[model samples]
Target: MGYNTFHTEGDMEVEVEVEEADQSASSGMAKQAVVENVALANALVKDGGYSWTSPSSLKLYPIIMLITLNTAMNGYDGSLMSSMNAMPAFHDYFNVGKQGPATGLLFAIYTVGQLIGSLFAAPAADRLGRRFGMCSGAFFIVIGTIIQATSKDIGQFMGGRFLIGFGVTVGCTSGPIYVVEVSPPSMRGLFGGLYYSFGYCAGALVASWTCYGTGKMLGDWSWRIPVIIQAFPAAIIFCTVWLLPESPRWQIANGQREKARSFFVEYHGNGNEDSAIVNLQMEEIERETNYDKELANNRWWDYRPLFSTRDRCFRMYLLILVGVFNKFVGGAVISYYLPVILDNIGIKSANEQLLINALNVVFSSVASVFGCFYVDKFGRRNLYLWGALLTGLCYIPMNVIAALAEGHVAKGTGYAFVAFIYLYGIFFSFCWMPLQTLYPAEILPNDIRAQGFAFQELMNGLASFINTYATPIALQRIGWRTYTIFLVLHFIYLGMLWWSIVETKGRSLEELEEIFSDPHPVKKSLEKHKIVLATGQGVKRKPSSNVNDDGFGNGCLNPRNKESLEKHKIVLATGQQSKWE
Candidate 1:
């Protein structure tokens, strides 16, 4: 075995060319993982570390892509359920009406299951590891999909929906966390955004088309087919997810230091063990991980650390803001209930509704992809502000048009409503959908990040439950007037977006800690200069905005471990894997 020594905490940057073909003494699962990772590193990471086409980067992308399916499954459910509601065969089979308590209970149960699952997702992610948590979630979905497809009664069908919902919460909670820890710091937004962006869109696209094809069927197969196919992504996740490398940060914090180091070397450094960028991140991970652990020694699992200081409590507030705003902004109204919404504005044909749903997903996907790429450039805070402004404003016109065109008075009204809905969908996809997982992953600290995601899922589930359960009844009772409520919500969301959201565009996981530490995190986060050290030196290139650093120009602004350097040691070994324990 060959490994390079990393002198990470220094002014001078060390760059070394690397070539490694190590196949250690290990056998079976562990050895297979090592060999596979080496192939992935050489094939994906070697050519250009930062480039999307780079060997290691390509290797990393597939991992992110697979995990994106977590969000895709949720999208699949939303689009599938909406299409099913429009299907005559489905309505006949289930004996459920479009607008009533029956649809509400069926839909609300999923969110209820998500709430229950949120309670366990954090512990699963933290204790068993991110990959395991994701896999466990996928496993439940596989079972749920089987049950849902084979359901002989409403009870069984609802039971399956609950399981699927629970599974989605768990997968969603951990998958984004894994992406954040593994993604390249500068491009974290793009990869993180992919979760609910193209991922969700892809799922929606498939489900809508599937429903359109099945809507022509004469029997229960119409709904069963879509429900059965829900297992496709979940099955893939359950079977293949373990083959991917675990989060290196998770490994380091949990005492698998050698494996963590190898991941950084192979994946992050393209097999160059001494990669400066990789080492800096590893050092920071070790530093903060230990400090957080020590800080919690006084009282374990009391939940005090989250509210231990003003800064942390502020982070909590941000978490709540993100969690609640994501669902409350009325995206749920479009997601699961769009078919019914279309009916109010005079488009009653099931086929047309399914087709429009498919197209809407496609256009929204385009918007999400655009947002995913430009997110780091425009910044999270700016996107939220603009996205809120546009999407919020869209609701006013939508409400006016819906009210005027109630019962499909004219073709022009229907066309106009579609156009407004498209704009609303496009703008929401451009902003909130992409950031739903990305922003929370960035803002939450490592210690509470997993639980924070669970909290996010809880808030998301609660809000979505309220929306899904109330939408049908409200649409039936208030007619076109239901649009007024979400319109009002968009206004409140816009105000909150302007007030509290912070810019997480150009910073690393550790760098965000300092920003949050400031009295005004939003103000500090908006500053151009940050300490990510994402590029320059031996890496691809420096951040375009100049860095504010500690005179050495290497950006060691907050020199950590100055006091505990002697007390806490990171044992490094040459020619062999170094396990921290």
Candidate 2:
């Protein structure tokens, strides 16, 4: 193997040769935190070396943004279809009604691809590595875009949509997990939320505007323009993803601890091997790496560990809710069929409908940005509850307005309905856009993250399929009454938001054990997090007080109450035979 070298703070800039870990690790040894001053742990982080604007952070953020943009692949597709609903040229060329089985199939086929693509999502993410999943997914989307844009017939168009769906699922399946894996623990919420808040919205923004710009044209180019535009984000990702680093946690899991340590030292520790920031991360990764061995015997294909316990079951419930709610609560309907919905309310000019859709994307993007930055500021549950309530309540007013405006150009009611839509869009994007992937990625154990997401995407694909297929049919048959279903979802989702969404703000990935292990996760998640930091040598520090200990203060990051060396005993016994490949 080729060697790369870096200094470890000697007098001279000595370049020590380090073996490159292009693949898995097999070492049985483990590293522990170095901080020995337990009392001085809380003050260890000086604002100086860990500046967010440091060169280390600058080099890191762009790679994350590139991988995260895979989300835009689907967002762009949705924008294209919704914009097409308002385009006469697309309907005329395709020879299909704006709201019927034909239109439903056209829109829903993308989700069919997602469902099928989901089958391989775990394999790609777990075995091939994040870069592989990202690069391959991007390739599929680009190819799918080519087929769809140049298609001569409906069958051709459907084939393209299927490929796009499959590609995006494979692509997106790794993105959130990878982003969360690499993000700074304190800023995990911000970076993770940006996966959708920025990437998905950026895709939506481009597509909506591209549609508006092309809709003014005279030929088949109007719809084809935006369809082709869907290729850009994935293309960019495909080209740049190989330059991205492998996840440090994945490196450790594979036993490349030295390589993982080097990354933490250079990027996270800022040339120092023992920065508090790097130490904390190493502490978390090492502990989780231990538990991951317990799961090593279970082949990558076995998913039983995801639901092997009651806590795991609650996590499964939360995953299902995130997946289903992402699409079912009227969001997907608005996303893919907004033009159709607007047409029903006397917004007759196709141009006017397209304009409204474009503006809504812009408006929602602003809310998404706000949500992204403040995700850690406002606890996940708080924002979700408020958004669910506000957006859900808007549906009732919208249903009432649509009911009053149907069959006649009641300009007043039509405008009122549009206003309500803007309201719903803003609030919905504020919470859901950021939380959809961020919450699930953080809650799931590293061992089962791929399996957990495989399950979540299944639920996501099912809900999306139901909405994409049923909404237009329901809208056509029942007119305004179709929204009543979402009103019901709104209520149920609001209750679940209050009961289920755990606040993960300011907690490390390994630290979340305290939250999930307690019977009352919501309550447990809310408590202030405590952790014992090691300087250079201690394996574990017994908490000074046992009566008030909540696991956070127990100097050990392990979920179990064992010293660090004891944990490595399990890894040593199983590490060699428990290979993923």
Candidate 3:
């Protein structure tokens, strides 16, 4: 076959050529990180590089915004519930008499709902398409909100909260996958991470201020209004999801080639079906998916690869650690216990507590917006390493000041502690909030992304449950020492990250698969990342001059070995060849 040279109207031409050669090297050779990176790079980028301001990017931005907006349900539910725990009317109406632990239990039960939702999130996303998965989740949230708004007893209140938790988990988990799968390589960090930053934080911001306003209302409406308001975000997602396109990657994997092609043309290439960019992406998806089927047999239960070898197992731990540390890193403690903490420190006014909560989330939301713009620019390793380091440092002075003013409230120390609290939120917004959702999505392969992401959600739920349930009790007992536990844990987390996690900036989703496949992915990744960042180009393999090209000229970018392609074809043909066999 001859090389195909495809070009867009305002873009440069890209040539894809095929040639025949001896397949000895690739025949017995296993797929590794460096080789995979080369193949993936060939698939994602065209000769004419697509930037953030291109026509395709402009067309795709609004669609990405819609998907990301689903995360608001998560943010709104969390902040609203945290604020409600501080409401005096809420305690009286729900009969939650003077027990602090009882409020903590309510929070813990909500996490249980999240646990249940996460259990089913993987199957739903894999069985149904991404669009339908999100819609199903939003529907659940709407039902849960309705149940909560009219509940008169603790049982009904908890049932409603559980349902909201379940629904939000599904939507939140699905939102990141959709953004990551659909985003262009250059814009992946910004668009893939925008949901956690803009959607979730925006939801929290609205909830915080909404609870403050509703607290002034006379009766049940004080708490019931915010509960009812929770339905709107889920409702918006449910209504609009059917109108959007399915993930192009998902479409290709499920064997919907023509449909996938049309989507890439319309949504990604702005209707330029012949665009070299579209052709390259489609080729990459088909080849990589075919290769994955050969490697893992396309079965969901084959989780052995995740923990079979040292490198793979290490990567799994890193993913789980991200989910765990994100919750336990002191932000959740401060978020749910802020009003209580403030009261103990002499800011005892209920109105002042609500106002502080409102301002904290509002400022945190602004920081998230800023984070979205800078995440790609900063790289994942730097963002996590520095963000964790800086935020952890802020806690030392904060704890010292709180201890100094423990019994008799010093206004200056109290205000100093408040500033530190806000500063902590600012650092967390920049570091964890955006990455919590983005990191796992980037690290996991497409074959196991659904399952891996689900696992992380499970970890996140458990961690959140413990922090929510235990933070109140811990603060009641140790006071400022509650801050000390996280201070130590933060450094431990930073050390683990430094030793293990690799930078995944300026690389496509497919390129990440190669990084994980390498035996020494952490080191190999650092080397590959440097090349991509320095040149704004993907890592390229050294060209062999000895290969003969029968169908394409010397200038054509051809696959080196025809025998390797034949071997790959044979491997694909062996449908159920399990490693265990």
Candidate 4:
């Protein structure tokens, strides 16, 4: 077989691109996986002149599904309070009216707790393992849930909300990092989007229906039951997290090299230590990890590089914008006070509002699933821009219909406003939900992934707090005109995303470093990525034993060991049906 090479490191390097069009001697299970995702066929690499194969994605399903429960736990808490606010029993017990500034503070305090928790999320994840951070968060949620369930006063209930928000901050921030690091490069978008977005929406769906069922009950048990149910997911995560594999990338970063290798082989490689995919993944991780360590700065101050350059600063801006707009545009108002929004649109019955809210979440969850299928396929830029555009356009008619309904200009305008609300959820799910969950983790580098995510959580909490706190006052005063503000803001968000957001689909995490490091990131990202895609080979030089004239070892970045390198070179001789020996 013949192969072409591209120089990856400095000078002393070779990159061979070989298209053998041959089948490898592989197990049935491995071969089956290769047939599924066609992109895996072209990902062959040569290490030390030896051929290597990639790993199967089938092994990733169990852990990805399990970790998503954490995100759903956060989502459940987010919507539960909104649903609870609809019940008269809850209002009577808390002694707070449904539509007022005091009600907004009660809701906003949870976001304050999340903001405080975000301050510690990075340190916890960086020092302890991903599993430990997640379990700790889960434990806190259980404590908070018990307090809320038994709360006798408004202050006690608000305290419970704070704890749940704080605990959820830890889980939501770390959970995505864990998923992104462990997932295969080809499937990161789908898995990340599905678990974070679709999973969260599913939890919201459950909360809506649960409140509907319990709201019909006679006493405080109506709201108390939903508050208590929040603990179940956290408990499941706390109990079973220990059994799951820790993030392989985190293991390697913390100097647990052998453990990292072992897990990569057993879980990612399916017991094949010599698998080409496993070796390439390990090599990339090692190289990046070592490069980051070369700086030797492990303190919180190390994150200064995230804004050292124009490109880096732009990325940070996108992240902050993502956090802010995700909550503010329409989601915060709809999610935190849907009953109030419906009330303004003339849907007077609380039960009717709760049932419609349940259906709205179900539809949004279903739409999120559809978006997940093509998030990677269509790329991030298109989804963000178009999703924002469509969602914004939906509001124009909604605002007009609601405004005209007040003047008795048309009959059944209330139902029209409700339809637009459901449509808004659908559009938001299609565009914003998946990307909001996936982009922050995707854009940040490995060394600062946890820290960057912490910043995002901080912004998310601040924005949610502001929006949740101010939404009730706005709804109480201006009514449907509050939508016009979001409508205008969506256009602003759409323009910024179109102009600044970089596409990250189908690229390796390591490759992204090069893209963002370039001076003209928005312009050069696509161009630089072409080089990475063209080579499709990752090369590392073996260490040499030569001594120099100055009595120092000749340590080169790309070592030249002719004998060892030739020994490592094993060719693929293809027959009528090409296969590896």
Candidate 5:
């Protein structure tokens, strides 16, 4: 029999079919089976009525705002300690001398804490749920900040800073993933960018204000006050996240379809003309079901496929390379060392250095805002390539000035460096910051998205850890030469950006699976051989409907029949040949 079709308010329709059978026993049973199939399909396709009246009507925006707030606190806690280091109380309490190891050690401990936090965030979020993971991290921050506030010695203060770093690490890892999952396809980049942009802005504001207000309060409580202030935000986030919905993707993966549906409707609204939320629950159910079926026998260890073959191996390597290099390319070093760098260049007074640092924050925050506006429009790769280029160019003059000058070079050099720093901040806010935040959320498949991002964060934390401690030592040993090192590193980053990085600007989470499935060869010899076959056949063949040319040379593997499903297993398993055409 032919399939029957029913129309909905939009052009969308549900197609159904029921096969007729003969009166014979076998045929009768077949007929009944067809009837059952028809019934189930009908139910799946039925119009549930518009639950989402308008995009603006959904409560999701408020929830997104909350996540942004939490993210801001993370940024603040992560960078605040850097600015505080210039305070007399912190310098005295820590026994920090100009460009001393103790100074590096104090700041480095926080990154070490972040490393530990990143290692645990994924499994915790997966097993205990996102809310629990977030709250647990927040709790850690509160305790850490409290200790930091009360610490009398450098060791105690280091311990507290580590704790705050650990907590904020969790927020950094989980917050973007959570936000990306809940957002609509069209608004994903905008909302996701907002989280990082606002977070960085708030962080800059905190560091600036804290330094400006308490620069002279060199008593025991001076630096402690900022550390203590972090607790309030943590406390608020800890309590508020409890009321938010667990990720619908996570719920569906755990086989809670009805609950996922309710969440999608309540927060996202039902798929109605007036509602902005299109109920993707049914689509997700089907997609996840297919994914589960495809990987039914797979185990957690199957993640080996991520690095099994040459192509898969290359992709993983590229991701790690970019992540690790991104950190070392002087973002963390600049962030942690900006005040000292300024002071060395003869800004003289601590207050002047603090003011310049504050200006850095303001300019970077503004760049972040502009980045949010154009990220989706310009695409990730465009921003990254140009941003790295501009940032690299900005570093050149600073390095030259430092290398040549005996004292403050010239007033003009200082002006040039200051101008370059703000431009660098803008470039960072627009390109590196948002791109780094968006990459982990968009590059990996659903099953491994959290795990992959955690690993990315681990790399970031490790880099930061090394930079935090090693920066002062490097500066001490190299003196003005440190700028030369960063300048070289930025060029390397520019090369990587032009070569391997893929554009994932406005794609959905489902769409990202396809984007990263195949490797993009940067080397000339391998580029020609990297063509993916549609049906595993060696001969050149027509591209399948599931494969889309993503404007990159390689084909993007669309998740045909699998994008909507919630499966716990990684999408690709070792020993299973890739099915992309």
Candidate 6:
């Protein structure tokens, strides 16, 4: 049977017509038929119905690696400039000394640019296609980096930074969605972790090395050198993007099923073995059409639907808490203002300050490596809880040292303060960084994933904007006591994580929608579709059907109830060739 002749009749059976090939080709045709049947069978079975399997091709990994590198450039641009801001020659050349508000303005304006980019560019990823949106983002980064390298004054420098932030906003917004769409379920968490881990590590490394080298060089070009080096990664990612295949899921969602199937074949390998894999993917895609329908009907302008219902509202509230608290616990303020903070603590030598910053980056890199291996095993909520607690604990001693160092503490306490801060970075890597990246992807339904993430980033950028300026003002007023304020915020964030966040360890995207949805409407909707399948009845039962009112007094499930009316999915994996027509 050729691929085109097969069709499904309801859920019961599939019909295929076997045709004889040329005399020399008959054996090849028989082999192809057998291959298709096995592939189809493996593809159809979900959960324990089929044996476990791995991805058929290695191409998927490189695509993920490139996206990770792309995301890392965002971190590099955001953090590297912070250390440069402290350079003496650069400070005099830009006329920023004694002008605290101007420094704050520079940071705030860049964030404002990022806010605009994330809010606008994210949705286009879904609308225009991932490939086009990502390529455009890379182009912006290259332009922004060039502007920064050539800036003649502070105003020009800020302008360049703003453009860089704008470009990075696309990377932060689209990178997660792209990685999630391309990865298989089993390895999703690991791949996603690698993206953030590498990005953060890159940011830290750039900050450390740039600060050290620029301080030693003792010239105006010291800072310019680091800013210019950023262009290298931007160029490499742009060139490599042409080699990546479009995300198969995105293609499928866009109604390019033939293209998606062909992509799977090209990547998965050519053999009788691949037919089952192709059919299975097709089934999964078929199951997700309703998700696409919901997304299509969503209003782009009004974000109220995200928080309109009980469960969704709860999820929205959780997302907001995570977004704000993640930045508020002092990670952004510390990272962006580390050199200044070190200066205030009596580490006057620029070389010492740069070395300390490098040490902090090293600790964070180690933590990220640990997190990549164990995030799935430990689960999301557990890590958040522990990360928050440890981070809060680390802050207490540092705050105490800061308070006492002014009067009674010895000079060596500066070393203690720096050590505690590095420990804080380690905890942040294991807990907050991973969860910030992981939770946003896990909590939202596919239709709203991009928008939900955009909102999260908006809040994060807003918090960071406040912190960027607020840290300097706080330091001017409180000296070292600012660490105490962070201590209190970390505890507050810990409580929120323990009480509100839900576990989403192994759930598929559809199952996640049901698990997090209001059970009542979901139950009512699923009941209507109960007759669609017999074998998968048990599968349906696993999804929670209870609906509850959103705490804000709105129903979480839409009263329209369109999902229940959808047809049951037909599972068709290939097996040994049969004589029946």
Model 6, 69-155: lDDT tens digits are: 667776676567666666777777887742266777877777877787877665667676666566767777788888888999877
Candidate 3 local Cα displacement, residue 162, angstroms: 0.6
Writing each residue's lDDT as its tens digit, candidate 3 over 1-581 gives 34343232224322222233123223322121121123223333332345455677777878887786678888888789778877889988877732268878887888899899988787678778788779888999999999999998988989998998888788777788988888766567777668788988988988999999998888899999999999997898899988888888888878898998888777666576665447656765776788767666455545565665554576679887778876777888778778777877778677888888899998888887888777766778888888889889998887787677678987666777889999999998977778878888888777677777877788888988999988888887788888888888888888988887887875666655555565667765565210010012222222332212211111112312122211111110011111110
RMSD of each candidate?
Answer: 10.7, 10.9, 9.3, 8.7, 11.9, 11.1
lDDT of 4 by residue, 400-509 (tens): 87677553443377778878889999998987788876888988877778888888888889998889888899888887688888888888888887778787775657
Q: For all candidates, what are the clash counts?
A: 7, 9, 0, 7, 15, 20
Worst 10 residues of 1 by lDDT: 29-38
Q: Write the per-residue lDDT of candidate 2 for residues 84-160, one digit (tens) a residue.
A: 88999988888988888889988889888989888888888888787788888899999999999999999999999
Model 2 ranges with Cα > 4 A deviation = 1-49, 529-556, 561-581
List TM-score per model, in order. Answer: 0.84, 0.85, 0.84, 0.82, 0.78, 0.78
Best by TM-score: 2
The C-alpha stretches of model 3 lying farther than 4 A from their native spots are 1-47, 51-54, 97-99, 295-305, 308-311, 529-581
Worst 10 residues of 6 by lDDT: 548-557
Candidate 1 TM-score versus the reference = 0.84
Better of 3 and 6 by TM-score: 3
Better by lDDT, candidate 6 or 4: 4
Model 1 RMSD, rounded to 1 decimal:
10.7
* Whole-model Cα lDDT of every candidate shown, in order: 0.73, 0.73, 0.70, 0.71, 0.62, 0.62
Models sorted by lDDT, best on top: 2, 1, 4, 3, 6, 5
- Give lDDT tens digits, candidate 1, residues 1-581: 22222222222111221223122212211111111011111112222235555566767877888889988998899888988888988777778888788999998999998999998898889888999889999998999989889998888999999999999999989989999999877468889998778788889889988998989888999899999999999989998988999999889878999999999777766677766457667766787787778664333234566777777788878888877765766677787788888887788898898888888888888898788977866778888888888988888988898789765458678878888889989998887778978998888878878877887788888988888899889888997778898888878877887889888765678767766776677776664321111111211222232222211122322323111101111111112222212
Superposed model 5: Cα runs more than 4 Å off = 1-58, 269-289, 292-315, 519-581
Clashing pairs in 2: 25-254, 25-255, 34-534, 34-535, 34-536, 35-534, 35-535, 35-536, 36-535
Model 3 per-residue lDDT at 299: 54
Q: Pick the candidate with the highest lDDT.
A: 2
